[model samples]
Structure formats: C-alpha cells, structure tokens
Target: MRVLVTGHRGYIGSIVTPLLRAAGHDVVGLDSGLFALCLLGPAPENPPEFDVDLRDVTEAHLQGIDAVIHLAALSNDPLGSLAPQITHDINHHASVRLAHLAKNAGVRRFLYASTCSVYGSAGADLVREDAPLRPLTPYAESKVRVEDDVAAIADSGFSPVFLRNATAFGFSPCLRADIVLNNLVGRAVLTGKVRVLSDGTPWRPLVHVQDIAAAFTYALTAPTDKIHCAAYNVGTEANNMTVEQIAGAAADAVPGSTVLVTGDTGPDPRSYRVDFSAIRSAFDGYDPQWSVADGAAELYENYTRWGLTEYLFSERFTRLNHLEKLLAAGVLDASLRFQLIGAGCE
Candidate 1:
C-alpha cells in the first residue's frame, strides 16, 4: 500500500506515519506546517512530503496515492472556537473536497480521523456509531459535518471509513500537553498536583496515541465491504472514565502528587461514553493496549527525562496557545494561512 498521510507531523500523525512505514507500506506526508514549531522533543524523520495546506490540495497531489489518512484540521474545541468559520473551512469544506479529489484521482480508500466528541453530552448512555450526534463545539460539529459529507460520496470505486477516535492521550515526538491525560500528568510532575478544572465529573473515553496509530494501520487494508461508509468509535468500554477518575490516575502516576478539584463547578456539557464494539468486529486484530494509567505514567517518565519546567508549558506544547502566538506574531494571517517571505513558503 502506498499511503498519503495528511498532518503527518501532528500529535497522532507523527506516530501513525512511522507505524505505516514499519508495516511495509510506502508512505508520504502532506502538512501545512502550522504546528511545526510546536515541538517538545526531536522531530521524527518523515517520508517524502508535500508542504501544503489541506485547503490547497489538488487532484494533482493525489496521483499514485492508493489511500489517504486525513488528520489535518483545527484539532480541538478551543482552537475551533478561536475561529469557527476557519474550522469549518478546513475541517469540513476542505475535507470533503480532498475526498472528492482523491476519489477522482483513483485513490481506493479514504480514512478519516473523526472524534468521539461528536456524541457530546449523551448522558450515561453508551453511544454507538449510529447514535444521534449532538456536537457541542465547533470542532465536534466540523467532524460530524465531514463524516456526513464524506459518507454521502462513498461508492463502489471509493471507500470512505470514519474512525471516531476517543480523546487521544500519550507520548508523541510532537507531544501535546493540551489533552486531558497529558495535561494532568504534566501538572502533577511539575507542581506535584493534578488539577481538575470542571468539578471532575465529565465522562470521556480515552485512547493511547499508539493505539490510534494502530487502528489507522488496520483501516488501510480493511475489507471495503465491511468499512465502506462505516463509522467506528475507536476505544474500549472499559476506558470510559470520568474526569475525577482520570485525575486520580494522574496523581497516582506521579509520586506524592495530590489531586485538586479546583472549584470549576460549571460541569462541561461535552460529556459522553462511547461504545467501540463496531471497530473490534470490523478489524481482525484490533486491540488497544494502553490504559489511562499507562498513558499517565508514560507522560510522567518523559516529562521527567526532558526536565519539564513551567516555561515549557507555554505555546511549545499546547496547540491553541501556539496558533494564537503565531497569529499574534504575524507568522500566520487571520485566515490561518502562512505569510510567504524571503524564500517561498515550504
């Protein structure tokens, strides 16, 4: 399989690109380099790459690509809320355009990295792939819109699979401290306290970053009859945990760290538990190995090794912070496009 992975330098993409290569697939990368400066550790050596944004991708870029694993977008709620229209442009409109281009260029498979966040606030119920979607934020709303549009275009020639991944947490070369487990562990190690901001009661399904990479690898060659236009929630039922439970896990991962519920009683309305049975049934060897405890421990060990400090907690490890800094510094324009200078932009 010759694969083209978008956002190949991102939190999950950095891990997924190497996984595809290790599995004997020829892989190429496409990224706009928005978060290229937001590095926590040494960057991974990527394959041949097209330094381009998702919105700028053309059918010419899809030539000879057997499949595309689309992971490019404004990835989180805060970033999406920062500019909702931009999020819709990139995450929804651009994504649908890419799928059409890929299909027109004879790309057989299109794997989309959707999110479990689409099942926002489905109180206490284990939501399945077919459950009514109620996206609370622009990020989740964009994902739902993309899933609908992409699925509508699926046909005998083009197979589109939607992997609605759980809240990803673990180590990557492009490490992110914005997500729940990573943020908790970073705070625990740096300040000896794990803080929960929202009264610690919102339910979230969490998955390790490596597990997400593995799931994408499986989808690359999954039976088209099984995965075509199918949406699969990608995490186990056992991993569905509340914010309080996650905080305890983070506290336990760091020695002598205490859990603090910081009076943020505004209970985040975006809480839901997901059912991942569809993925297990669809993929022959789908198995997610990392638990919340495992992810927290990994973050703690890596933070310690890297000598984490309060200063490192700025835009360097957080996506929203980094983008805001770029926009403020004029590196990225108001529309989130890079301003070309001296030599042409990469």
Candidate 2:
C-alpha cells in the first residue's frame, strides 16, 4: 500500500508513521514543518515531508499515492479558536476539498483522524460512537463537520474511515507537553507540582499514543467493506477517567509527583468522556495493552534522564506551541483565551 500521511511529523503522526512503515506500507508524509512546534524537543525524522498547507493541496501533490491519512490542521481547541474562520478553512473546508480531490484522483482509502471531543458533555462516563454529538468547542465542532464531509466520499466508492481518538496521553516522538498526562509529568518535574485547572471532574477517555498508532494501522489493513464511511471511537471503555483522576494516577506513578488541588475554579466545557466499543467491534477485540499509568511512567522516566524536563519548563518553549502561538497572535477571543491559559493551552 502506498500511504500518504499529513502532519506526519506531529506527535500522533510520528507514532503512526512508524507503524505504517513497519507494516510494510510505503508511506509519504506532507507537513509544513511548523518549525515552532519543536519547542518541546528536536523534530521527528520523516523524509518527503511537504512544506505545504492542507488548504493548498493539489492532485499533483498526491501523485503516486494510494491513500491519505488526513491529520493536518490547526490542532487543539485554543489553536482552532485562534481564528474561527481560519479553523473552518483549514479543518473543514480544506479537509472536505481534500477528500473530494482524493476521491476524484482514485485514492483507494482515506483515513481521517477525528476527536472524541465531538461528543461533548455525553453526560456519562462511557459515551458510545453512535451517541448524539454535542460539540463544545470550535475544534470539536470542526471535527464533527469534517466527519460528515469525509463520510460523503463513500458515494463515489472511496473508502473513508474515521477514527475518533481518545485523549492521547503518552509522549510522542514529536513531543508535546501540552497534553494532560505529559503536561502533568512536565509540571511535576519542573515545578514539583501538577494541577487540575478546572474543578478536576471532567470525564476523559484516555489512550496511549502507541495504542492510537495501532488503531490507525489496524484500519489500514481492515477489509474495505468493513470500514468505509465508518466512524470508530479509538480507545478502551475501561480507560475512561476524570481530569483529577488522571492527575492522581500520575502522582501514583511518578516518584516525585505531588498532585495539587487548587480549589474548585471555573467550568470547562471540555468535560465529556467517550466509548470505544465501535473500535473494538471493528477490530474484533484489538484490546489496548498500554494504560494511562504506563504512558505517564514512561514520560516521567524519560524526563528524569532526558533534558525534556528543561525543554518543557523553558519560557521559550511556549513560542513553539502551536496553540500558544495562536493565542499570542490574537486569533482567539478573550473568553477562550482565559480558559486555555491555564491548560498550558493543554
């Protein structure tokens, strides 16, 4: 299989790209290099990375490719909130156009990386894939819209698979200290404490980066009839946890981590957890082996020896954050800014 992965140098893509290669598929990656994202560490190695925008992709750009794993976008809520219009442009409009173009170009299969955040306020610990979607943020909303666009490609006999991934916790080759688990580990190592910024009760379905990679790899090989226009929530149902629950779990795994309770604060709209029954059913019991605890421990152990601790702690590191860059650029409004400021924009 000749696979094309966008954002291939990103934290998730870094893990997914290697998995695709190991499975014997010839893969090419398209990325902008967004050099600023290297604040956490060095770049993840990937050749044939296009210095292009997803909004500007052409059929010529995709020449010789058999399929596309669309991962490029202004990822994260703060980043999407940066310029709501730009978010729609890149995340939705361009994405829809890409699928249409790919389908027209005879690409065999297209895999879209969606988010569990689309099921906002599921009001339950385990929200299934077919559950009503209640998107809470521009980022989540954009994902919801694109899923429809990708699904539409099925009319043309193109196989489009959607993976609504869980809250990824493990460190990536393209390291991001912006995620909850990595952020917790980074804060504990840097400031000796990790905080749950909100009331710390938000439910989040968690998964390891490797597990997500495994899910993508599984989708690549699954029979076309099984995955076309299908949306699967990639995670283990038992792994659903709360914000403070994850912070507490990290405290248990990291030797020096002291989980801090900063008092009940504001309400975060990003509080819903997700269900993974669809993915499990799709893969027929591809149970994830790595848990959030395992990922937290790995991040901590690596931070202990590697300079990653300093890398994440540095003020300069903020400049490399895509989400932070969006805020500094005033692409986001004041209200969204206030909420994400404490999230490390996490």
Candidate 3:
C-alpha cells in the first residue's frame, strides 16, 4: 500500500506516519509546515513530502496514492475559534474537496481522522458512532460536516472509513501541551502542580497517540466491505473518564506533585463518554494498549528526560499559542496561509 498522509508533521501525524511505514506501506507525507518550527524534540526523518496545503491539492497529488489519511485541520476549539470562517474553509471545505479528488484519482481507501467531540454533552448515555452529533464548537462542527460530505460520496470503488478518534494524548516528536491530559502532565512536570481549568467535572474519552496510529493502520488494510462508508469510535470504553480522574492520574504519575482543582465551575458543554465496542467488533486486531496511567507515566518520563522547562510549556509545544505567535510575527496571515516571504506558501 502506497499511503498519502496529510498533516504529516502534526502531533498525531508525526507518530502515525512512521507507524504506517513500519507496517510495510510506502508512505508520502503532505503538510503545509505551519508548525515546522514548533517541534518539541528531535524530528523524525519523513519520506518524500509535498509542501502543499489540502485546499490546493489536485488529482495529480493523488495520482499513485492507494490510501489517503486526512489529518490536516485547525485541530482544537481555541484554534478554530481564532478564525471560525477560516476553520470552516480549511477543515471542512478543503477536506471534502481533497476527498473528492482522491476518489476521482482511483484512491481506494480514504481514512478520515474524525473526532469524538461531535457527540457533545451526551449526558449519562454512552455515545456510539450512530448517535446524533451535537457539535459544540466550530472545530467539532467542521468534523461533522466533513464526515457527512465525504460519506455521501462513498461507493464500491472508493471506501471511506471515518475513525472518530477520542481525545488523543501521548508522547510524539511534535508534542502538544494544550490537550487536557498532556497539559495536566506537563504542568505537573514543570510546576509540581496539576491544574484543572473547568472544575474537573467534564467527561472525556482519551486514547494514546500510538493507539490512534494503529487504528489508522488497521483501517488502511481492513476488508473494504467491512469498513466502506462506516464510522467507528476509536478508543476503549474504560478510557472514558472525568477531568478530575485524569488530573489524579497525572498527579500520580509525577512524584511530589499535587492536584489542584480550582473550583471555577464554569459550564463546559463538551462532555461525552463514548462506547468503543463497535470498533472492537468491526476490526479483529484492534486493541488499545495504553491506559490513562500508562500515558501519564510516559509523559512524565519523557518530560523528565527532555528536561522540562518554561520554554517547553510555552508556545513551542502549544498549538494555539504557536499559531498566534506566527500570526503576530507576520509569518502567517489571518487566514493561516503562510506569508509569501518565508519558505513560499508552505
């Protein structure tokens, strides 16, 4: 399998690309290099890459690609809220356009990296892939729109599998410190305190980044009949936990660290516990190996080994902060397209 992975320099993509290649697939990466300077540690040597944005992709880019794993987007809620229209333009419109081009260019497998945030505030019920999507932010809404548009174009000739991934947390070369678990662990490792922002009551399903890479690998080679035009919630049911639970896990991972629940009590409506039985039943070899404890321990070890500092906690590893810095520095315009001066548009 010759795979084309978009956003190959991102936090998850950085891990997934190597995993795909280790699985014996010939991989080519496509990234606009927005976060090229935001690397946390050493960068992985990637395969042949195209310095192209998803919106600019044509059928020529997908000419010899057997599978397309779409991961490029305005990743989080804060980044999406920074410019909502640009989020829609890049995450929704560009993604659907890329899918259309891939299908037309004879790509058989299209693995969309969807999010579990689409099931917003599913109160005590266990949300599944068939549940109604109640997106709460521009980021989650964009994912829903892309999933629908791409699934509508699915056919026997083109198999599109939607992996509705849970909140990803783990170590990657392109590490991120903004997500809940990572933020908590990073804060603990840096300041000896784990801080919870939203009262630590919201529920979130979490998955390790390596497990996510494995899920994509499974989807790329699974039987077309089993995965064609289907969506799977990617995570184990046991990993669905509350923010306080995750904070405790982080605290336990770091020695002499304390958990601080700043009782803000603000209303966060993005709480959901996902049921991942569908994916377990759909794919035979699919099993998430990392627990929250395992992820927290891994982050602790890596942060210690890499010498945790204030710099790592700053814009260098945080996505929204890095993008804002780039915008302020005139490297990226308001629309997130790179300025014509440095490295030309990529």
Candidate 4:
C-alpha cells in the first residue's frame, strides 16, 4: 500500500507515518509545516512529501496515492472555539473536499481521524459508534460533520472508514502537551503537581499514540466489506477514566507529586465513556496495550529525558497557545495560513 498521510509532522502523524512504513507500506506526507519546529526530540525520518496545507491540497498531490490517512486540522476545543468558522472550513469543508478528490483520483482507502468527543455529554453511559452524536465544541462538531459528509460519499470503489479515536496521550517526537495524560505528566514533572481545574470529574477515554498508529495501519488494509463506511471508536474500554484517576496515575509516575483538583474551571460538560468493542471485534488480534498508568510513566520518562521546560510545556507544546503565538507573530494569518516569507505560502 502506498499511503499519503496528511499532518505527517504532527504529534500523531509523526508516530503514524513511521509505523505505516514499518508495516511495509510506502508512505508520503502532506503538511503545511506550521508545527514543523515543535519538536521535543530528534526529527523523524522524512518521507516524500507535498509541503501543502490541507485546504490547499490539489489533485496533483493526490495523484498516484493509494490511500489517505487524513489527520490534519486545527485540533483541540480551545483552538476550535477561538475561531469556529476557520475550524469548520478546514476540519469540515476541506476534509469532505479531500474525500471527493481522493475518490475521483482512485484512492481506495480513506481512514479519517475522527474523535470520541463527538459523543459529548453522554454522561456515564458507554456510547457506541451508532450513538447519537452531541458535539459540545466546534472541534467535535467539525469532526461530526466530516464523518457524516465523508461517509455519505462512500461507494464500491472508495472505502471510507472513520476511526473515532479517544483522547490521545503519550510521547511523540513532535510532542503535544495539550492532551490530558501528557499535560498531567508534564505538570507533575515540571511543577511536582497533577492539577485538575475542572473538579476532576469529567470522564475521558484515553489511548496511547502508538496504539492509535497501529489501529490506523490495520484499518488501511482491512477487508473492504468490514471497514467500508464503518465507524469504530478506537481505544480500549479499560482506559476510560475520570480526570481524577488520570491525575492520580500521573502523580504516581512522578515521585513526590500530588494531585490537586482546583475546581476553578467549574463542571465540564464534555464527559463520556466510549464502547470500543466494535473496533476490537472488527480488527482481529488488535487490543490497546498501554494502560493509563503505563502511559503516564512513559510520558514522565520521555519528558524528563527530553528536558521538558515550563515555558515549552505551557506554550510551544500546547496547540492552542502555539497557534495563537504564531498568529500574533504574523507567521500565520488570521485564517491560520502561513504568511512567513520564503515559507512557501500558497
């Protein structure tokens, strides 16, 4: 399989691209290089790439590509809320457009990186893939839109599979400290505290980055009948944990670290447990290996080994802060498009 992975330089993409290559698939990349400098460690091995933004991807970029693992977007709730229209433009409109282009260009497989957050405010019930989606934020709303629009275009030739991944955590070369587990670990390592601002009550489904990469790799070659237009929630049910539990795990991983629930952000409405049985049964021999404690430990080790700092953790590694900084510095325009001189603005 020859795969074209969008956001191949991103936190998840950096891990996914290499995993695809190791699985004997020829991998190419398409990224705007916005987060190219947000590296926590040594850079990953390069693949044949189109240095193009997701919105600017042309037919030429899709030419000769067998499949597309779409993972690029303005990810996270804060970023999406900051500019809802831009989020819709890129995450929803551009994503559906890419699907149409891929189908027209004869790309067989389209594995979209959807999120479990679409089952927003489902309370304690274990929401499955067929559950009614109640997206609480612009980011989750955009994902819901993409899944609906893209799945509508599925056909005999073009297979579109929606992998609704849980809140991703774990260390990547292109590290992200924005997500739950990573953020907790980083705070514990830097400040010796695992702080939760939302009363630590929201339920979150968490998955390690490597597990997510493996799930996608398997879906790439999964039988057409099984994966065609199917939606599967990635991650294990065992990993569905509350914010308090996650913080405790992080605190355990970092010696002398204490868990603190400030309750400053108030009660969060974005709470839901997800049922991952659909994906587990569909993908034979596939099960998420890392637990919250293990992932927390892994993150703590990596953050310490890589010399994580308060400034880097708070700003550069957090996606919302990083992009806002870019916009303020004029490196990215108001639309989040690159405006840097000689940076190949399209």
Compose the digit string of candidate 3's lDDT tens values, residues 299-328: 999988887688767768777888887788
- The regions of model 2 sitting more than 4 angstroms off are 35-43, 309-346
lDDT of 1 at 56: 97
Write model 4 residue lDDT over 1-346, tens digit each, in one string.
8899999989999999989988899999998887877888788997999888889888888889999999999889998999999999999999999999999999999999999999999999999999999999999999999998998988899999999999999989888898999999999999998899998999999999999999998898788998799999999999999999999999999999999999999999999999999998888878899999999999888899989998889878988888878788788899988888533211
Query: Which portions of model 3 miss their true places by more than 4 Å?
Result: 340-346
How high a TM-score does candidate 1 get? 0.97
* Whole-model lDDT per candidate: 0.90, 0.76, 0.89, 0.91
Question: How does residue 215 of candidate 2 score in lDDT?
Answer: 90
Give each model a TM-score: 0.97, 0.89, 0.97, 0.98
Q: Write the per-residue lDDT of candidate 2 for residues 54-109, one digit (tens) a residue.
A: 77789887777788898887677766766688788888998999888888888878
Superposition error at 111 for model 3 (Å): 0.4
Candidate 2 Cα RMSD after full superposition onto the native fold (Å)? 5.1
Model 1 weakest lDDT span, ten residues long? 337-346
1-346: candidate 1 lDDT, tens digit per residue: 9999999988899999999999999999999987765566676888999999899999999999999999998999988999999999999999999999999999999999999999988988899988999999999999999999998988999999999999999988887888999999999998999988798888999999999999999999888988888999998888899999999999999999999998566788988998898899999999899999998999988899877777667557887888777777787899998885321111
Q: Which candidate is the best by TM-score?
A: 4
lDDT of 1: 0.90
Least accurate stretch of 10 residues (summed lDDT) in model 2? Answer: 336-345
